[model samples]
Target: MKFDVLRAHQGDKWYGVGDTRDAREVEVQHLVDRGVLRKAAPDVLNKAAPPVQNKAVSAPKNKASK
Candidate 1:
């Protein structure tokens, strides 16, 4: 899992922007429990921030003309 450093901290290395850590869930939770890290806010998880092609189909526009 990923975590954002809420405060400065060190383990095997420093943790912060431009050099984020990829750690196990438990490892991240440990820091959060100790007030060292925080859950990252929700953001883009795709090639771009997306509505992702708007796949929901709409009813035919001319339904009453059938």
Candidate 2:
């Protein structure tokens, strides 16, 4: 799971404040329980947004015959 470091901590790995990193739940469950780390917000850059069509489809115009 990914977590946001709320405070500087050290374990099997070192985590600094404001750092976003991924770790196995089993490995960091203690820190998470202690509020040292919280779930990180999803990264927008990594998410793929659906393609959008901005142009509106228009019907063909007909000319009147005299």
The TM-score leader among the candidates is: 2
CA lDDT, every prediction? 0.67, 0.82
lDDT of model number 1: 0.67
Cα lDDT, model 1, residue 35: 72
Clashing pairs in model 2, backbone N/Cα/C closer than 3 A: none
lDDT of 2 at 47: 68
Residue 7, model 2, lDDT: 90
Candidate 1 residue lDDT tens string, 1-66 = 666776777777876543455678785787779877766655564136546687787777797855
State model 2's lDDT: 0.82
Note the clash tally of each candidate.
0, 0
Report the number of the highest-lDDT candidate: 2
lDDT of 2 by residue, 1-66 (tens): 788999998866787898886989888888889999988777875468889977996655755532
